[model samples]
Target chain A: MRALSKKWVALLGVLPALALVAFACGGEGEEGETFKIGVMESLTGPGETYGTVAVQAKQMAVDEINAGGGINGRMLELIIEDSKCNAQDAITAYNKLTDVDDVKIILGTSCSGAMLGAAPLAEEEGVILFSGLATNPDIANAGDYIFRTSLSDALLGVDTGNVLWADGIRNLVTITEATDYAEGVRRTTVEQFQKRGGQVVGEERYPSDTTDFRTQLTKLFNENPDALHVAAQAEFAGGTIIKQARELGYDGPIYGEVVAIGTTALEVAGEAATGTKAIITDLDPANAKGQEVLTNFRNRYDYVTLPWYLGSAYDNVYIAAECLKQTDDDQDADGFRDCLYGITWSGAIGDDYSFDQDGEVVGLANVVVEVLPLAERTQDNQGYRVLGSAPAE
Target chain B: MELPIIGDIIRLSRDPKDSLRLSRSNLEFWVNLLIISWAVAFAIWQGVGFAITVGTVFAIWAILSVSLNLVVGFTGLLSVAHIGFFGIGAYAMAILTSDAAYEQLRTEAIPTLGWPFFAALPVSVGVAGLVAVVVGIAFNRFRDDIYVLVSFGFAVIAFNVFLNWRSLTRGAFGIHEIERPAIGGWVFDGELEFLALVLVSLAVVILIAWFLMTSSFGRVLTAIREDEQATEVFGYQVTHYKLAIWVISAMMAGLAGGLFGSWTTFVDPNSFVLMESILLVSIVILGGLATIWGSLLGAMAFVLLEEGMRFLPFLPSEFVGQGRQVVLGILLVVLMLFRPQGLVGRYKL
Candidate 1:
């Protein structure tokens, strides 16, 4: 019995280590005709909807690349992992992609928390993790391997401030959803709002998934700030917070970042959602360039999973595939990484699309949209109104 | 294999001939204990080793369940608030062990707090116990049902504190990069090593609970549970006895929490929600409530149930991504309605 226990223990010990070794030392059984890129995104939880968009966009990019002779005659294959918008799960997925899948490049991570965790892991493991949705700058600094296509939380803060300024609201109250992503935007918005001569009323925070936001709403309403700044991801919490604020009898302008919930936020908040000032960075699916990509993506994927975020994702895959086309089929991690850094294009969002050393989208613009009469704004079958773009000076 | 006290516990906890012997009883217990210990040893010897992380989770949760069993099972008090207690220990130890990390993570400025490793453990346990003492006094008037509601309410309140107390707890983003514990020029840096510590601590806590369960006080607590009115009629001060056990259980929870915080090196409000407390109770109930061995077995089962499910990733990607808690919820319902006596019922049906 003792010997058996010892044997079991030894086997258990050796098994995990052995598996880890196999995973880390993955070899190409069929190395000939494919460049595999990992797409790690939150398919569910806080960022589920956005993740759907990212997934489709990534697929579109894959289809486009494969059609273009498959990254220099080698077809592009994407391995997808759903992060579930959590750090632990995101990290595990990240390790699996980099180690087991042996993906030379990554298109990834929508949730800020997921991005933050994954960014660090990617940096530690030296895998290039470029994301389209996570906005926090801490994510940018997590490692050299980390990069983002979305606007920085700091810049988003400034853009939101610009919207508030344009809308003629100078006194702002901030209520962040109390995650690193939301909190960073909240702080940045406050800094920019105050810097631009806006009077600050007060600030408060609530945990995510809170059903009763009455306590925080009561506080924000009592402050009577000219505008209320809601910093959150698009989800029930942000929308519900706005709805609760409205129910508390404050009908002021809502200056929101990405945290205004889904379009459902507008549906739930109703009249209160109107006059909401927001800075959006999503693709205008109706634009000639975006429409062409959207049509192609639809025909290719059988359905539009999420039309907006996926455009950029589609671009990312094509971008990586484009880079791979220039590299030797049997290059090392560093060589592949170098090729990834060198690619630039006129694709999905706009022309001269390129990444900086920090892996941030350079020369990007934020499109400011106002919550208007749903009838007037509803056009072209797209869910939102694209008023205009705001590029940072 | 004959020692009086050990023999008594085995006869009481692992009686194979009583027909109460669960499938794989002795073998399961010893194997689990051995595996758990081995996992911990590997983590300590290695570094936050994966298997060790699995083992640490079991040990911490098991010990936590045992501690909570004192309140939920013996005293018949219902408080989903133990997760809050778990949070307290985690937060307390984290604030101590990761003072530098806290300073970096928290936005607001606060005074630096640094304490020795041993000193932090006692402080965390003390704080959690003290809080439990205060909460127990206020909510002791209700029966278990209302008690659960009120306790759940308290857990929400604690969760709010964890989330909004940004200066202290860093709200929701989680305070990260905590330093490992240092003792005599050696740091407990690896998860396997950490797991070993967790197992030893879990064993010690369970042993203490075993001692308490068989003690005169344990009898009184059980008496109060089965018939509080009868105990009251018998001239026992039920409130005081209940409070004593609550405090003891809270200390145990705090100890487990400190170890947990140390191991994760990161703490967040999500870790302390009411559901976690409920999960702890489920483990205790599953392994036969009011028994120390039950708590240990339940904790092991709980961890295994959780980590084991990951082996078969059969769900569609969409369901797989967001379905963990949903599955847990269904399992809990099944366990509750079908196996009410629990896997190791105190008196098997």
Candidate 2:
């Protein structure tokens, strides 16, 4: 009995010490000479495809900045962590980044859930958590330190409404993935479309992991609206929805959000995806800098497909670099946050783009893209044709 | 070198049977108290705010694991839907106390009472217990494996309701700006204060669990777990005992969930998924079933292992997050192989 008690006591004594040692492992990065910026992406989950692209874009930007004399002569190092696109994982990743790695500026969080989970912690820790692709409207007011270069779903929803209205689609039915990203877009689009004198005939939502949309699509098809809006995170789901909707024999104009514009949609839906339109942040093919980025990304990755947030992620790294360059004290989180708030620059995405007080990117122009046949699509495009820029709100 | 009285106390604590006499069984009790107190003091002294926050979260998980142990460990019922009760308490507290609830009320043009955090606790507990009664009545018909399946289904259904019920639960967007617990104008806003609240709650929960474990009612539960048919032949209504214990366990889980929602100041459907329920079961199994203190140790070990993986220098930064789960999987396998009953558990699987 005494031996048993001693064994238990010994185990208890060792466990807490192990915890303390874990907390004490990571040494602080050298002051001012090497700026450590953390990156939290969903590297190995449902958001893996987009996360991989976003990380590549961020790395491309970081390499460019280093190649051009670095950020104020201090080499920028990115400490990347996976969020797994979940709130709990995001919090853990955030804690490690702030406490262990000691990074003040964080570029991350492709998913809305990840951003929301880390926002309060970032606010408390006084770290600047800037997202490359999180677009949930709730994030606009999440924290003073939380900012995003990507356009909010609110803006994209309004753009979708305006573009559909301009195209003379009067009645619409919406199908959304039951995630924060897709739901936010669906809600805002329905509201904005209704306010613009367009009628929403019906709306349906399904969980993110769901593969079968036959029931929902069949039901939406019964409404026989002028258009069907697909609000989904993954292109596979979006494409499946389109293919299944077409199989149901309702061929009215199909609209998609920013999430539906990638090559996955085309690959899954095949020829049925042609003529599908989406509201996407226009990447100007004519611009020299945009072409340069496109060329570099293609050469490095050997992948023709570009996810929606690739441009935003590329531009976010430059934004963080520019913010660090402008700060009087680069080491101060508050100073870096303030400098980020005040600065504006044109990059691969567009011109004169800056963050508003709520940390939303200002003057982000949206354009409508029509999925065209392989032969009709430009060499620069995967399967999309830029169908004129939408009027800026 | 030990004194006679101290030696006796230690011997009494190491005994497998539960005891109520403080003079005989105070060793385990005092050791647990000292370990918790020392951990709290060490976290604060380290002055690492993240460590404090993680410690508070650990306390919350400990509370949950202990409550779950009441049903799964003591009663031998594989109730995986404990997270359902947790979600119920969280959503109930969030809806009853949050400013969002007030706004929602105004939007619906309904009258609002706006319950405070403390006032909301009983409501949350009652709601969880009430739901447990309904589920328990329906589920008590099923035996062993079927019960596990039915209970797991409950967790999935509850998660869906929390996700799709936008009018009440706000669906996937989650309720934000939840008010932290306050006492006579002193809000528990800081990490230390929140940690203190969590620790106090854990202590109370441990006391309740200990009391129950050492009582006649607890012995009946153990009997039911060992052999329901034999226990029933002894003139006990097996269903009633099961239902009663289920309700108590659920109410305890609800209390823990209420604390969690307020501590994080946010509650989303994702926080209470089937994975979370599995995690609670793992905590009990790892700490050793039928042992109250084992649950606490299991929670500590689990949280420490998960968080400690972040500090492994051998793992590259990119692989560290996912690699943590890999290492944890290996550790659990090794533990099961070496110590199947659990590290401190007296019961055999």
| Model 1 Cα shift for residue B26 (angstroms) | 12
Across B1-349, the per-residue lDDT of candidate 2 in tens digits comes to 1123345446667863543344333344544544455456445634486677678778888888988888888888988999999999988887887764334321111123467889998888899999999999999999789989999999999999998988787777777666688899999878789889889988988888888888999999999989999999999999999999899889988888888777766677778888889988888888778887788877876776666555555565535556666877887776666557775565764
Off by over 4 Å in 2: A1-25, A28-32, A44-49, A67-69, A84-88, A100-102, A294-306, A374-380, A391-393, B1-47, B100-114, B346-349
lDDT of 2 by residue, A1-393 (tens): 555555555555554565556445534445557777899998766677767778888888888888888877888878788877767678767876776567788998987777877888889878888997888787887878999888888778888888878888898999998777787778777777888899988889987777889999888888879999999987889988988888888789999966576777777887788899988876787766777887888898787455447888888888888777777344588888887778877888888878788878897777888899756665478678888877443
lDDT of 1 by residue, B1-349 (tens): 1122244346657665672344223333443454355445434433343455566677788888888888877677766888888889888887876655333432333445666566788888999999989987987777767887898898899988988887777676665544467787887764456667888998788788878888899899989888899999999998889888888888888888787766655566656767667777778787666666666666765665454333223444334445655665565575555446554455331
Off by over 4 Å in 1: A1-47, A51-108, A115-130, A204-225, A240-252, A270-272, A284-308, A312-361, A379-383, A391-393, B1-49, B99-119, B184-186, B323-337, B347-349
Listed in order, each prediction's TM-score against the native is 0.79, 0.87
- On a 0 to 100 scale, what is the lDDT of residue B273 in model 2? 81
Give the per-residue lDDT of model 1 (tens digit) for A196-221.
78888888776667668888778877
- Quote the lDDT for B12 in model 1: 54
TM-score: which candidate is best? 2
lDDT of each: 0.67, 0.78
TM-score value, chain A, candidate 1:
0.83
